[model samples]
Target: MNHQKSSVEQQYVLFKLDNEFYGIDILQVETIEKVMDITRVPHALPYVQGVINLRGEVVPVINLRKRFNLPEVALDEESRIMIISIEDMIVGLLVDSSSEVIQLEDADVDEAPELGEQKDNEYIKGIGKNEDRIIILLDLKKILGITDTNEL
Candidate 1:
């Protein structure tokens, strides 16, 4: 199998959070599911909503809004859970909604800007520009603080 991409445009799974658009590498995404019951975990991080029984496999779920310190809103009809794989881990992200996959060219993506703390912005992979839209591409490992420091 050829691992090389057929096109220069990279594809991403787009989701909405707090009305802003965010994208994750499509290759890392397993599936997108509707909002389901989550079992709360004791002493888990504030952003972790809980785990869900996904096909007998318990997958931890995180609230993206909470993870980003955005205002919380009650999950409604449009709510969804994005199941993604990062390295050896599989986790779900509770998003406001997700319904599309987008393609972005290298020239259309800009490096994540240096926010207040450059080190704190590693989770943002880049900013994808498509016409009037701007999608925030994310690095799941950095967002979940799962980067292996041992490799450093």
Candidate 2:
């Protein structure tokens, strides 16, 4: 039997929420675009802004701010939607803005802090520190409820 360590690769698309930086796996992301009109849906979750016609397909958009219980901010030109596919479901995450993608070595990622029994902590994968900022890496599987791993 041969015992050896295998290298792990991680690619992240970093974006801003509030004043903090966060990232999600690049493989999960489809595309990013500026904020667009989302039709209001009746009896929908507060975090869910509504659905949009993305190339003749109806895609639901989630307000990252409302989901995280952050203060509301007016939608502006700088706002963007990160369209991602989780288990074949196309979801759009509304973010404050967009940023560059980064390749992170495994060593660069650290465990997320336990913030005293906060419910949302489960969605965070870990914390990544680089240069002058700390990026909160998200657990896409958990956040998106992607049970079929093969689909991704």
Candidate 3:
């Protein structure tokens, strides 16, 4: 095990959603792209915005706001699509805006609090404290709805 406590610094790709800052493991991020034309996929989950031709691959995109049940808003110039691959499943996450990448040591992270019995809150991995900022660290596995490990 190469894991160390506070000695290890983990990088997170931060983004804004409904004015709140959120982050995901930097390793899972493939690229950050500007908003592009998306083709809607019928019978898909509500959160799913549909697919895009990323290079030659058709990657599915999801709106973070919809996924979190936040009020929807129009995309602006600062809007971005973060391409992330978790457990061999590659997808694009649409965000209000793209933020800079940040590093946080383990000591800077606190476990996420229990937010009632809502299963949606389970996607939060921890709370990262950076200076005066609070970044909600997200668990991509749960966000991607990957409940079956053996099936993968």
Per-prediction backbone clash count? 0, 0, 0
Each prediction's RMSD to truth:
4.1, 3.9, 3.3
Which model is ahead, 2 or 3, in terms of lDDT? 3
Estimate, for each residue in 18-72, the C-alpha lDDT of model 1 and write its tens digit. Answer: 8889999999999999988999999999999999999999999999999988999
Find the number of clashing residue pairs for candidate 3.
0
Please report the candidate that would top lDDT against the real structure.
3
Off by over 4 Å in 3: 1-6, 148-152
Q: By TM-score, highest first, what's the ranking?
A: 3, 1, 2
- Choose 1 or 2, whichever is better by lDDT: 1
lDDT of 3 by residue, 2-105 (tens): 75553689999999998889999999999999999999999999999999999999999999899999999998999999999987889999999978999999
lDDT of each: 0.92, 0.87, 0.93
For each candidate in turn, the TM-score is 0.91, 0.88, 0.93
TM match of model 3 to true structure:
0.93
Candidate 1 is scored at a TM of 0.91
lDDT of 3 at 3: 55
lDDT of 3 at 88: 85
